[model samples]
Target: MYRTWMRFLTPGPAHHRLGLVCLGVGLQHGALPTVGPRTLDHHVAVVISAGTGWYATPDGRRTPVTAPALLWLTPGVPHHYAPDPETGWDEAFVDFTGPATAPYTELGYIEPDRPVVPLTEAAAPRGVVARIARAARRDNPLLEVETAAAVHELLVTLRRARADLAPDGDPVLKALAHDACTPMTVADHAAKHGMTPAELRTAVRRGAGCSPKDYLLGIRLGRAKELLATTELPVAAVARRVGYDDPAYFSRLFTRRTGMPPVRFRAQQARAVPGGYGDRVPDPDDPPMIAGPRRP
Candidate 1:
């Protein structure tokens, strides 16, 4: 006997601008039936939390799947799979597609070439699925955006849970982020870590899905933005804090990357405390209001 709970969604065009939209979600267990010897037009992440199954390609090659695994049924990929007849399986799946899928796939978060992924554990991804399911209720006005947000979280959670990643996460990426404000060149950073520049680039690409220089630049710029938006520091001081010695170069790079000069960005985004600024930026989604000084 098999049991299933599923919801299919059709979000409007405007919601697609959010960059990721959900098409469907499902949670199932028991002796499930075989899936396609066919192809799909969109992507599906079928997460198996329990039991065992076998996945096959159109070429008839089969890959065995145990508990805590993910099946990436990507667009136009011929796929076939089913659970053991007697034991069945417990599974959750999210079907999503949008322009953002291209970049995500390119970034190594969604692997088309490696369809069957072993997961260290499915709990984190399953929790995101449960959130999506809750948002799936009929006539829930926020359904589209809510589920879409959860899909992004789902992708990130799945990436982190990949069996290949160390349980504590990528040490090199962590170290690089820690030292991002030290004004080191990529080669210099590589030497500090006892690696050649080429080897460091490869490691960062594998762990973070970007070149080392790009990764460090992202960290430095993020910190610079936080300082600009929360403090009264001069642009030159902010630049120096984020590893750039030249204020002119920093302003030009910031403008090119963010489409605004630092002063303009500060004017628009500043959330100053009366007497202090925190090191971290608050989440824009639920930022605390900073009350200015009382009127005399």
Candidate 2:
């Protein structure tokens, strides 16, 4: 029986981020006619769970596709692939791209030269694609964000799986670093990745030389500093912007971490630059005023 489901996302500014945006997701079953032998403008990842197929590249290179494998169709690359007539494959796919995509390529997660990647286990990839498909069906207000996040997770999963075969560094570290801005507790963050708090802490410490809580706090505080330096927002507003609820607590934490309050830091920054904080030049003759050592 032939069956196919696809969801194409509308473009939106909010979906744009350092990480990839999921442009579309789909699932297909049964043999299909040859698609492409043409080029595309965006990337597509096809995970084949069953049956067999063949994919052809722009340079006239044809690759045999078997079950339990992934086929990557890179942007602007001429390609064509189709399922076997006798044994049509079950395929799940997601299309995505962003500023972060190139880094993945450089990191060897995605390769243009090699189109087919065999999967030791197909269930996880299939589940993620199913999640994207299901979420796309809901058409939620946060669909873009949700799908984008799923795409990121999918890529991380692929990379980690590949890494396991070759024995690279821990993937949890990368996941933690990517999710640092979200206002979740370390335990919650750990749980999201199926790790206990203790396990997460140990992994993070081994990978980043700090506890997960400290890592998240550092990200929040850095954002808080940027807001204080760049905007005229109230202290409370800045605190909220960086995930703090109580202004007083944020102030105390800021003071504890930096050895000066947010207000004082802003004032010092403003004074350091002539005219205003936006001005690039500091007073040439003015001695640099250093804040006290940061708390451990």
Candidate 3:
């Protein structure tokens, strides 16, 4: 028999987020009679690291889910599920959102009509249990600092590993990096990777799970977001700094990817900061703008 443990985490409003969890596995069970009135941001997720459980809707729809399962829940769908008290269960839960959630929801990674998304595996819980245990030992105040980091790690890992995922261009992925300071054209990039346009598209989609162009755009947008939060760069400069020559085009693309234009993204973020997100102080010695995302 395998053993799994769980440690529950209650994050306050400031810390509400989705990802890895400090919740160690608890007792194992086949079913449960009660569950939570828990409500998360827009995306609610749960990972069944150990034990057996079922997710139930308000309408009494019960579905059994086992260990090593991952669940992503849609927003505003009231539902509840838990381990069978007789058999017991352990799980880590969290909430997530942003523009990405909508696309993911459409993909059926979660139940569009319902609130919960589930992924399961027999072995996942055993490993996740070990991870949570170790994290708890190293960090006492769960959901304090280390717990958040662990949760993020778990979320990243789980999202990257599911379904019969494709290869996702090992080369194309390698080509596109977070650096948006400068970048090469797709044509040139394809040649450098020794691929034709069609072949390049196929390879990238296979390995990375998205088209090459979309993949590059994602990296750029992610980097842009980092700058918006951490730097004093003006939004226009930030757009060019991230490779878009036209700030307007950059804004459109940014909005499409992040669900907020660069300027508004910066504004909303600045408001979230304690003393405001600092100030936009342009560097006098800033370097010239580059064309695209950086390559490896």
TM-score against truth, every candidate: 0.89, 0.56, 0.42
Q: Residue-wise lDDT of candidate 3 within 1-296, one digit each (tens)?
A: 23434455555545534432233324333344456555544655566656676787667788786665665555666667777566766555544444445554443344447444344342443354346546555356553446556544444456444434422324446655523246566666678778788887777665555676776777778778877876778878878777887888888888887787777777777534334333345577984344687789
> Best candidate, lDDT-wise?
1
Least accurate 10 contiguous residues by lDDT in model 1: 272-281
Of the candidates numbered 2 and 3, which has the greater TM-score value?
Answer: 2
The candidate scoring highest on TM-score is 1
Clash totals in order: 0, 0, 31
Question: Which is superior by lDDT, 1 or 3?
Answer: 1
What are the per-residue Cα lDDT tens digits for candidate 2 across 169-200? 56886676567666678888889999999999
In model 2, the runs with Cα more than 4 Å from the true position are 163-296
Worst 10 residues of 2 by lDDT: 271-280
**Of the candidates numbered 1 and 2, which has the greater lDDT value?**
1
**Candidate 3 Cα RMSD after full superposition onto the native fold (Å):** 12.0
